[model samples]
Target: DADRNGFVMGEGAAVLVLEDLEHARARGADVYCEISGYATFGNAYHMTGLTKEGLEMARAIDTALDMAELDGSAIDYVNAHGSGTQQNDRHETAAVKRSLGAHAYATPMSSIKSMVGHSLGAIGSIELAACVLAMSHQVVPPTANYTTPDPECDL
Candidate 1:
């Protein structure tokens, strides 16, 4: 499993509803969790390649955490964008360790790309839905089929 290659392309669709806290409460709706924070940036270095330095992704993580007024220690889980490529795995690992620092070692991170295949535009929503379910159930999903440890992608 550690011997990575590429993601399995998939076709699917998912939808998630976003509701304000007060509005949901007013309607007696089930609130999953707060949206907290998110960040996005352009990796202009390459069209399809990412830097092993992971500076871009790390900065995005830092910005999101800052916006949420939370630190890496507050994170309970990480839904990694694990694309199964060697570069993606190492890059993601590096970014997480940089942004999360010591907490990265404690946080549980996984990717459902193997299970659901990489659904491209739909994968993000699907994964976000998984996060909400995980929060509701108080469970974190594991990286599927992982047997050997690739020290490069540790944590």
Candidate 2:
């Protein structure tokens, strides 16, 4: 479990079959959803540390939303990068709130790592699969090991 202090390292692999909507539709492919937006930014502050205010992360998220032409209120779910470390959990929650404001609390966010354990660099693909599965099954996968809420991560 990843909720204790740090994540349990694990090994896994996932492959997402993506195609252009027109090509998929022509071939009768089952399209899940579209990747409407993407953005990236480097903090360059630390290899193992994040900014205290999480402004850089928030900026990246904001950029994504702007690219998608969507507002925070339009967000339905948040698939968080919850590494299960004290610093990461707190910082991620705070960053979401900073980016999405009151809508952050309205959105149901969860961490797949809590259930499947962390797979390091492979996590993003796995988490995206989790999101697609949740959408397909209409379920919000529980944060498996979560129990008490920390004051620092009051999301």
On TM-score, the candidate that comes out on top is 1
- TM-score list, all predictions: 0.96, 0.94
lDDT for model 1: 0.88
TM-score for predicted model 2 compared with the true structure: 0.94
**Clashing residue pairs found in predicted model 2:** none
Q: Please write out the lDDT profile of model 2 over residues 44-119, one tens digit for every residue.
A: 8888788667787788889999999998888889888888888777778878899899999889998888888889
Give lDDT for model 2. Answer: 0.84
* Candidate 1 regions with alpha-carbon error over 4 angstroms: none
lDDT accuracy of residue 151 in candidate 2: 73
Task: Give the C-alpha miss distance for residue 125 in model 1, angstroms.
Answer: 0.2
